[model samples]
Target: MVQELMLTLQALGLPRPVRGTLASQLVREFHGKVSELLPSLPPESMQPLLSSPLDASQWEALESLSQSLTEQYCCRRCLLLKRLDLTTSAFHWGDRAEGQGEAMKAVLFPIRGLLTPESDVSVAHVLAARADLSRLVPATSVAARQGTSCAINKVLMGDVPDRGGRPDALEAAMPAWQSRREDGGRGKAGPQRWGRRKKKKK
Candidate 1:
């Protein structure tokens, strides 16, 4: 089938290109079978990424792609990510978000090839939802603390005292206690007496 196709192309423009056409045909077939990678990560490993403060995945993908593209035939790895069939690279963890970003600008088109229209839309939607959620939720402990904890108009507890003071002796002591004229100046427990003193005639 390929020979006939190559022969036809030769008649028009590829008279000397047998190998290049055959290679192209093989690549097309290969991509069809390989376009199933989806960049799978272990639940344990993915947990940290999910818990991370940053919601952006593009940065992670770009970082990974940056290192991968410096190697030979980088498209293989990228295609694997795009297809979502991460079974190929089981332990191949990376900052894929960053790598993918860098790959988009690479001449090899490695990034674009893996990211299809549907996947792009899905990613954008997820990032948008994340951003929306981020606004609704507090980003830090301090931010969460700043929110009101109660809906009541007034505090149930009385106003907190700014400074501490000792209770007055009159308030703390009983009415039965009597303070002598001299005892008043000296804050000592006055002698307790039930009746007044009687005057003795000389």
Candidate 2:
């Protein structure tokens, strides 16, 4: 079923951005045939998923299957690392900023298939859940490494352990694993460079 879903989605060619389930990235491509698939997707069809037990193995399987499909049909590779290295897995998520004045600091993330249809959770709540994911991300990695930067301008995992202060210090010690980029890449950036160019006074 997973493979079929992957194949069908690939055939439709949706522009899925890089997403992480258990520290793995998805194949984000700029395909033009996404509309056709949307209609085909039956909303209720996903309900059966809730009944099935979702243990660690099940999650692992889902991750593996997605990774395989990403490599096969999407012309992409998949890899996993600790959640801490979110700077890498972060991709284009369409995180649009909301409101004006005092409410400007907070941003809104795109949530289409993420929330369960059974619930009536507010968008803020949904974004909060994602923020929770971000908080844990820092803790899941040990070795300092970069995976994928991101496209939605910035990478916010949505993990806010405390809607208060910067997440705990644990996230920094975690380790991360990810796929190598073409230029042997990294997701995040290094120290800011601020230097003036030489003037050409001819």
Give me the candidate number with maximum lDDT: 1
What 10-residue stretch in candidate 1 is worst by lDDT? Answer: 41-50
* Residue 2, model 1: Cα distance from true site in angstroms: 11
Candidate 2, residues 1-202, lDDT tens digits: the string is: 4554576556665443345532223323323255444567656432332344567987777667655654554322112222322532243233542224224222322232232223232223322342223333552354322443337647568765665555664356666875455455655455798899889999
Name the regions of candidate 2 deviating beyond 4 angstroms: 1-46, 76-202
TM-score of every prediction relative to native: 0.12, 0.16
**On residues 44-85, what C-alpha lDDT tens digit does candidate 1 reach at each position?**
332322334543586677556644544433455566655654
